[model samples]
Target: MVADFDTIDININVGPQHPSTHGVFRMVLTVDGELVRDLDAVVGYLHRGAEKLLENQDYRQGIGIQDRTEYLAQFPAEQSYVMAAEKLGGFVVPERAEYVRVICVELNRIASHFMFMGAYGTDVGVFGTSFIYGFRERERVYRFFEELTGERMMYSYFRVGGLAWEVMDGFEEKARALLQELKRGINDINGLLTRNEIFIARTRHVGEISAERAIEYGLSGPVLRSTGVRWDVRKDEPYSVYDRFDFDVPVGEFGDCYDRYMVRLEEMRQAVRIVEQALDQMPKSGPIMPEKMPRMLRLPAGEVYVPVESARGEYGVYLVSRGGNHPWRCRVKSPCFTNLQALREMTVGEYVADSVVILGSIDLVLSEVDR
Candidate 1:
């Protein structure tokens, strides 16, 4: 016989389809009154086993598959895989190609952050404000991407050695104009959300985590920065011509939902700055792909790990080559997987409704987590 507590118990299923869960994620919540006593995130409803699938496909073909893993941050996924292959294969990317990759990845970061902001706002009951603002800014970035890669979402633009496509004529000018408008829109969004008293009250002290705890949980990007750690893979690791750019890694004093939200908001501004600098300093001419780029890329027998500062955080890809076109083994270290581990720690003792806000603040993609 089990001893039952005097307090009432209630069980709630958050979702396999909840808007706040974000992409086929479900959570089983055990609550007493409004307080969440125990929480379990049930994932794998979206698992496609991308790593296993990649082992059977050619290197070029695998890039397209990686795009679907984290659909919102497709550029970084592709970038991480491509960089891994390049390192393993000893391919040298031209200066122009590196600059182009930087611009694309940073722009994608803004788009990903926009999606997070919109979803997070809805989670907190600020219905339409974040949605309108986020997608409004996202449209400009998508337009630029559509023009360059001809695909808005699943862009397999990044290849093993360089890029699949080159920058089109007048692309620089269009990118500049789009980024300028985006900067203004970011300011307007900050004024609308960050300064609002209600927004602050809802998130300021909620889902609080210390810098020590964040590091212990292997947190990165805005989540870690929100705890006042100024670590960024782009700056610290310096891959794909990021070292040439001048930008600040924004940090927050409090590690709360609001702090994470604000840190990402500021990160968009920094991304815009880096994009502008990349556009100005980009080389005039070079081969987008290597001169001897093979149609079937076969790497020497070895392993390499590449990490990129994705919109989410440190997105890493580890590849093992067996002197063949297909990788012997491939692994993706998705940030969402590690970040989601911190959820129960953040959510316990908070209200059930606040769990949604907490999840939104973490900004996990179920595909990435389950992969």
Candidate 2:
């Protein structure tokens, strides 16, 4: 029994402007009726020569560039960039500074995931309710960030050897209170979408990728974890003070859109745990920066690469020094760009509408992809 029709495949260009494309991204989709036969993703429309630009900026000034490169999770970007310099210079970060860095970055991870849940809710057709719920909690974190760092979004708070300055007064009280609030917020978001039949129908088993394929594409963060891969850089490749924290790395079995959503939801809870521990273990009083630091930082001739587990995935910085205040070459390893590579593999053979779901699940920041 064969039923064949002479249907012509039509090409549709989605974005560089389309709202669902997530950023200034363009993808040419070859469609046969409602099915996606092929997808050609077009990036670089938002490119700003971030790496080349980093070469021109000094170590201190470059924190701002890292903020923009992964704006959604600026702390990780700033952390990676600064740690590279610290490594090359053999600088020691005080214990208090390490704990503070962990706390702030973990909170940033929660905020970034909240942003994803908000936007991904819209993509899954839950629209305003999830968007509002997600942002409500995100705003709370942002307000705290503004108070501590003096900048809401791109807080270049991290410096070469340590923090630019010690944290604000009542840092522990505020951070612990914020963690409690985030716990309740995570529960709220969970209740909103976790059991919703429509949400599950839309996301469950849609855009499925096998664990092996996910690793093959160099996927990381929630995307790779969703595929049942126990490969979190925080746990497997202990950076910062992550080795001291005991938080579970969430993974999913099906490796579908639903798994991605669930992984991020659970990750938020784990972030809260890490923050609480960091607050408890942090030194009561200490210097944020090391003593006897030179006015100008000039590293010996060498190269070093430092990677941190960002909200997205592995945010790494490769620094090449020639004994100067500025690096000879600065390279950023962006997880979004690498994760986006699997979009075509995930989209082809799925419904055209599911393409939006697939891309949304990636939770990419255009700046990271274009950086």
Candidate RMSDs in order: 2.4, 1.2
lDDT of 2 at 183: 89
Model 2 compared with the native: what TM-score?
A: 0.98
CA displacement after TM-score superposition, residue 133 of candidate 1 (Å): 1.6
**Highest lDDT, which number?**
2
lDDT tens digits by residue: candidate 2, 240-290? 889999999999998899999999999999999999999888999989999
Clashing pairs in 1: none
Off by over 4 Å in 2: 1-3
Each model's TM-score?
A: 0.97, 0.98
Q: Name the weakest run of 10 consecutive residues (lDDT summed) in model 2.
A: 1-10
The 10-residue segment with the lowest total lDDT in model 1: 1-10
RMSD of 2: 1.2
